[model samples]
Target: MPDRIRVLHVDDDPAVVEAATSALEQEHCGITVETATNVADGIERLDSEAFDCVVAGYDLPEQTGVEFLDAVRKRSPDLPFILFTSEGNEAAASDAISAGVTDYLRVDGGAEPYARLAHTVVDAVERTVDDIKHVQNTRRERAIEELHSTARAFMRATTEDAVAQITVDTARAILNMPANGVHFADGDSLYPVAWTARVEELLGTPPAFEAGESLAWQAFETGEARVHDDITSIPGRYNPETDIRSEIILPLGDHGVLLIGSCETGAFDDTDVTLARTLSVHATAALNRLDRDRQLREEREFIDQALDTLDDLFYVIDTDGSLRRWNERIPEVTGYSDEEIDEMSVSEFFPGDEHETIGAAIAETQTSGRVTVEAEILTADGERVPYEFAGTRLTDADGTTAGTVGIGRDISQRRAYERQLERKNERLDEFTSIVSHDLRNPLAVAEGNLELARTECDSDALDKVSRAHERMRALIDDLLTFARAGETATDIESVTLADIVEDCWQTVEGPRATLVVEDDRQIRADTAKLRRLLSNLVRNSVEHGSADAQTPSGHTAEHDGESITVRVGIVEDADRHGFYVADDGPGIPEDDREQVFEEGYSTGENGTGFGLKIVQRLAEVHGWTITATESEAGGARFEVTGLEPA
Candidate 1:
């Protein structure tokens, strides 16, 4: 039931061809015959027409059938060739068969020879075509197997460098290329990885893509593979030599592109296009996953940095009241390690009733999805640490409470500062009240006495009363100055003791108090305080000493020379300066020397009990020490030392 098998007959002899065609044409009952007379003419017929089988004479006057079979094999190797000959010469038939001839037919025999040759040609053609198809199927299966294996290997790669290297190796193996490389685009720079032996020679530093010319842009615009058959002539392509012929670009992912190059033009065919598309789909998906993972890693690092930077104790707790997370500052605040905190409960941290309160609040926050206000906590050392804690529920995507999130700020120092401020304010109020009530009474009595004596007393009595009033007023002023000293501050400065002594000398009242300025007598002090201190010293010297007094032995009289004996002398004492107020008068007794500086303690009948006290207060304020002893002049000597040079 098969269709007719057409046969082309070629021979130099027409008799041999007719004999064979007549006998063989009817054998299959579905065979047809076409004849050519010579090898050249037979090849011409084959070129102009189609035939499944060819029958030719072994010997031809122009060319032998063996030669004709060789010619046919050059153009179509799988086409069937059969020789039909009248020559019974076995040698020529054997020669034709040896020269790649399929079969031979002898005209002396019946139609059997022709029928056997026609059936033989039909079987040969079918088997050759089947072999070609099988080879192609095997090649395709091997290519697919390699692609799947390469994809698996690529997926296991961890870093970007590893991914690029795997891509290049896989591309080279699958594409059968001599060289391959992967280039990553960063800004306008191209970074190459996994370079092969001939990579530099084939592809030098490629020119940067123009703003509008990129593999990503071209693929998006066309939604197809971007193939460059001529790298040297393509607009955005770079070719270092004429040998660099082909390139194929595939999108790797949102952020990158994959490029492949071949030395032979048209190497990337339809199969390559399909394979590349498949690879790109998987590569893009894998790359997207990697990008998401990198972003999440960076975000976590940022959060950790922020938490570590904080000074306060930050912690999180689970619904079971277990500490889950904390910062490094936790050990400084709670005296507990991360491992210890992990085992502790809410009650273990806050003691007594506060423990219950905090626990309830934490539970409430976990249940209600709200923030719990600050509550006091007890440390591991049993110290009542003042803390402000706020907790909120942590929920999952399902909006369920996961745990209690809290931030604990230690407010103990702030609370202590507030308490100190309150105490200071209370002390200031009491001090103001006392200054108004207790001190003003004594001042009022002294004022009334002076006013009464001014209108009711005579000359001698008035003079004595006026002197007393002046002393009382001076005492009041000194008291006010001492009170104000405690309330204010003075500017610290370098001062000259000689300048202070000169200023005090001009202000002394009773007698001549001279100033002695040495060449190097500069001192460091609060200038204003030093001035007040020296003025009081000079006044006391004048008030208590005599410029001209008879010696105890009365052996020496007053000096006849017209010079004041009362003089200020400056001298050095170790690292300090000593200013001595000396006079040729009676010396003070050793016992009363220390008692003179006590407030309201006086020896003179007209003394206000505040003169020496004022001097002592000023000396103490200026950080100086004053000593009273016998002077070189055999008189009262008040030496103020501890004077630092400016």
Candidate 2:
């Protein structure tokens, strides 16, 4: 209901007009009275101003109250009109009712009649407002349903042009906006792609908007929708002289802009903008989907080309063991046609004896997500060729194992190389046996003879012979260790660094040297091999760090042997985690550090030179890396890295 009800009162008598105005205004707090002395003045006020209802006396100067009501109805058909008069007659009442009067009442000499008239006027106005609202709501609901149907069509669109055309058509049919168009974004401009027939009829064909050329481009660049109630008021309109007076430019994300225009000023309201924005949203989503689909197609093509170029056989198999996809190499290697390969299962390509193995590998891949196996592939001619196949399980969206994708590589060359290495290792083992047994017996005989001569004559020559024998024995022992260290480590277990360091120190003869273990982190390694590796390093530190120690038969030191301090600590960094052994003795020269690991490389007399090399080999066996540098104490630092934590 209106907060205030405005009423126009018309009567020939000034006294009666004043009395009626006073009565009506006094009847209700919300009623306002405007006075007119005749029908002419009343009609003039009704046309020039807005009033909720009209009140006129039957005895007007120029016309009856029914005639004035007729004039009001001609301008506003639904506006409330009341005929309030002192003259009462059945014929007059009939005329008032036929003229579409909202209420007919007799103006009695009392304030109660005025109150009744005021209440009737309010009721009529509220009824009219309610009827208009019902019609608007019904129309709004229908428009919304139409928009939903149009949105479904948008989703079905397969191309950018289809989406643009649908957007233009929806604006025309649903929004009742006939002068509409859509421009797709291209490089440096928006090209007109779809437009309605009414757009061409009203303003010819819309032009393409270059960068910074039109209000459409402005909306596109800013990513904001604009409603221009009057195109003439806008400064940078594309066609200021065009017949289109109002426009709504909505940006369609990165795709383009949707332009809606009308020939009448203020033709488009808030409802029009809202519906147009909804259409633009649906259109933009469709365009994005098309773009993603196009990209996916291109990516699939690239992958197909890449797979065909593989030298090895590439294949994808379903969980049922049937082949789904394969590269060109698969058919060529198997000597089978493409159609035959596709129809056959993966186990069919292998010999009957290898089917069980291949089936097991496939089952394992499904359970573990990956597997590798070496098997023989039986060709069409019934010849078997060795292959190393690697497979990884493929999963669907729900993470169930859908199939397996993998490659099969020919392993003929690798097999041949392995055989050759096996033969070479046999010969090396034979050579090591000769050095350990055949050479050791003769050297021991010489040592026994030299000892007997020493007791008989006390000669320095006997001592030299004895030292020579010891040097030979040391060489044989080091050679044996170097041979075994090259083999890859398989028996790995976690061992504590501090325990190993202390154990090695106990075995090493370093009475004057002090051992400082800074870290006790556990590391993965073969315990026996680790013990051997640490023993060599600890003995080297003691032998080289002592000041008054004599060089062994063939071992030597760069620094004068003296009382030294050796530290065992953890080495932790971004790329590595391991331990370091550093001493306070004189460090090796930087130029000699690289050569120190080479076999038989030494600087001192009577030095075996295999100690550091054996350290390097042992590290390689465990897949660890060793580097030599100067310690903070100006001593040699050996850091062994790439260790796995226990």
Best by TM-score: 2
* Candidate 2: tens digits of C-alpha lDDT, residues 1-646: 7888888888776766676677777767788888888888988898677798888888787688888888888887888888888985889989999999888888784767767876777788889878766755776778889989988898899889999999988888887888899999998899999999998898677799899988999999999999998898998888778888889999989999999988777777666777788888888888888899999999988988899898898999998899989988888888999989878988889999999999999999999889999999999989899999999999999998889999999999999988987887888888888988998889888888887888889888777887888889889899899888877687998888899999988888767889999978888899888888988887776666666433332344445444788999998887788888888776777877888888898655567889999999999989899988989988778999988643
Query: Which candidate ranks first by lDDT, i.e. highest?
Result: 2
Stretches of model 2 off by over 4 angstroms after superposition: 1-157, 166-178, 186-189, 196-205, 208-237, 246-254, 264-282, 298-316, 325-342, 367-370, 377-400, 405-417, 448-460, 549-562, 603-605, 644-646
Runs in model 1 lying further than 4 Å from the true structure: 1-155, 174-178, 197-224, 229-236, 338-348, 374-384, 421-646
Across 25-123, the per-residue lDDT of candidate 1 in tens digits comes to 666666788888888888998877767788887677678888898899886676778776776477877777777776776755575675666566566
Candidate 1: count the clashes.
0
Worst 10 residues of 2 by lDDT: 548-557
Q: How far does residue 303 in candidate 2 sit from its true spot (Å)?
A: 6.4
- lDDT scores in order: 0.67, 0.85
